[model samples]
Target: MGRTVDQEVHAAFVEFRAKEDDKVRCVVYFCLSVQCIYCQQIRAKNTSRQKQHLLECPGLRGHPNAPQPSQPAQAAPNGIGPPNGYPGTPNGPTATPSGPSGPGTIPAPNGTLMTNGVNPHATPLQAPLQALQNRAAMATPVQATGPPSAPPSAASRPTPKPKSKNSTSSLPAPPLDDVHAAFVEFRAKEEDKCLSVQCIYCQQVRAKNTSRQRQHLLECPTYLSVMKDSIPANNLLHTFPEGDVARSLQIPAPTLELDFRMSIKMNPKVNVGAGIWGQREWVSFIGGQWAGRWGKGIVLPGGQDTQLVTKDSATNLSASFMLQTVDDPPAFIVVRTDGWLTGAKDVLEKVIDSNMADGVNPGSYKYRVNLSMETGDERYTFLNTLMWIGSGCRRGHEVIFDSFRVN
Candidate 1:
């Protein structure tokens, strides 16, 4: 038939003992079993008492048979226990035993009428035991299962702190000693103002803030590439909007034109020197007068014109002079004239032979001059922004240049 109650109970104890270490052993004494480690003091021969002792024993901490706080000996919240408990223990109330012991009956921990490992007569004690078991289960930490969770998203993380204004200032100052030594660099005399720097690359003299100066050093293609590393990248450099540079650099077309008659008093040419290129002649400008739609102006004296007569059938001449207007508030204009005289015959020889001033001329020569003028006069500041194309024609003791603004 089926196994006896003693055999089943003993089998359960043997199974438990097999899973434990030698530190906590189950010992049999006649009809009872006890824990060897704790049996010396209590001297209990009951298997149920031995199980209770094993639960509380300090030596059984790491043993498999040791009780876990999560899985207590008492029934669960809905009156559920281990599979070895009596019938109806998982379903509802404890099942009543037909006799003192039956096939489906389990022994109680205390010395009382047992039914499915629970005491049928001990109704008052069940509440306290369940409370203890509930507390133990609640105190235990539940383990996670499945794949590990992903890290928090960038948006969820705490925002980074804003960098101080001086953080990027740590980079070494622009290397003024090396390649940029030719550039004019000076700090602003006033506090909190930008430095005045004359960039040799663009040949522009302008005052730029520290941040813009650093950005220029980084963005300028003419600057030495190796020197760019001296400045650290910062938000200020990138704050400028895209295409803003292109828009800022968009130049407008010229709109106005002027033709002026100029009288020139030139000095005798002096041979300066000769080089592999050609001969060089120094021509000094004594004085002149110019009158046009703009106004009447006097070409001040003390200007010099350098002529480079090359062997390649070409002549390049450059003249630097000043022009003073006869306006109510006199304004001074700095003029730089560069010209190219091409063909075999020299430009001065053509002027004399053709008798251009007397209205006797042949269209067999070509001489063109470009004029760059800079003036501080507010009324004529527009001359600084527009490009002018000028062509010179000799007329007697005077020269007439038709200046057309390239529209």
Candidate 2:
């Protein structure tokens, strides 16, 4: 409805003005306005004070624009031109004031900022004050006894000088990109030898332990187990942040617990399995086993919450969590097994071809099912963020994941 005469819609605006977002924005706008006003006032005062002091200072005495006793105050002398008011002008400081002096300065007649009908910028300093002007024109307090005395300055002031092209301040020395480059070169020398591995480039450098290789047996099984696990692991998107580097420990092939790579290398056909709760659970995995387009990969059944319940149900398996960017190549895959399922590897291959170059769409690939399982101190705030792997050189790739019971 239209408002009646004298009735304004301002009330309607003011009434709804305090909504959460609106009130917050309003406060921000108000603070900004106040700050702008204060800044303008400060700038105005500084500019005005600078011009006034320049008008009466003597240290500026030798300056070409400095006022002289012999010269009658020149006409509206703007800063710099031909003579007195101007740099090389004829009727500059040498010229007599067409009018007598009493006022400090006249305003700039052509510009805005007129006060008392005077163009302040147009005003020239009166030469009569030359006697009173010191290197600094000290506006002093009058002592009842002595002649008008020069007063101490409220603050110390520095004399200004002409700048030259040769002045160090003229051109900032070029940014020290050279110094930065040198730093990079120096750091390169301190890098680990392994970082120079062939066929790969990294934005980071790692440091190697100079000490002779210690017994790697303990971690031997761990490494193979991890790689074996990840070979067919599924990934979760929007679960980890962008640019995050992940690390996981793979359990060795079950039979030869403690070490699988060594076992595999020793025996090309070493059966791998899981051992937990005094039971043995073997895993069957292979790639490119069947005819054309047939699935070829490992199998990992979606973990059951029951795995954490009784010792009998638990499988001595270790899995690491990693994030795969939506639409990116499959970084991992996990096959599900139901009591030695038939054609286990086929499922893995099916999930692979479906996901390869097409990971964004759902059900396109077989994934180790996650029922929105959140365990550790999940970074809930950044759940939807893109995730990437960290530099092994920068962050140690030994991240550990602990299982928590979910109700």
Evaluate all candidate structures by whole-model CA lDDT and list the values in order.
0.50, 0.23
Q: After superposing candidate 1 on the true structure, give the runs of residues whose Cα lies further than 4 Å from its correct spot.
A: 1-256, 346-362, 394-399
Question: What digit string (tens of lDDT, one per residue) describes model 2 on residues 61-120?
Answer: 455434333333334456333333332323233322222433333223233333333333
What's the TM for model 2? 0.17
lDDT of 2: 0.23
Worst 10 residues of 1 by lDDT: 12-21
Which digits, one per residue and each the tens of the lDDT, describe model 1 over residues 1-407?
A: 22223223332232111111223322331112232332223333575664455556565455444343333346658877545433343335553333356533333433354323445543332323333333434453423121133222223533323324453322234543433453465432222123345556654444433454454554444553333332232123563343334222223344655656566666666888897778897878788988776788898988887888776546687989888999877899888878876654554465533244345342445556777789888998987866666676555544456665565
Worst 10 residues of 2 by lDDT: 258-267
Q: What are the root-mean-square deviations of the candidates from the true structure over C-alphas?
A: 27.3, 27.0
Runs of candidate 2 with Cα error greater than 4 angstroms are 1-82, 86-125, 128-407
Q: Give the TM-score of candidate 1.
A: 0.34
Best by TM-score, which number? Answer: 1
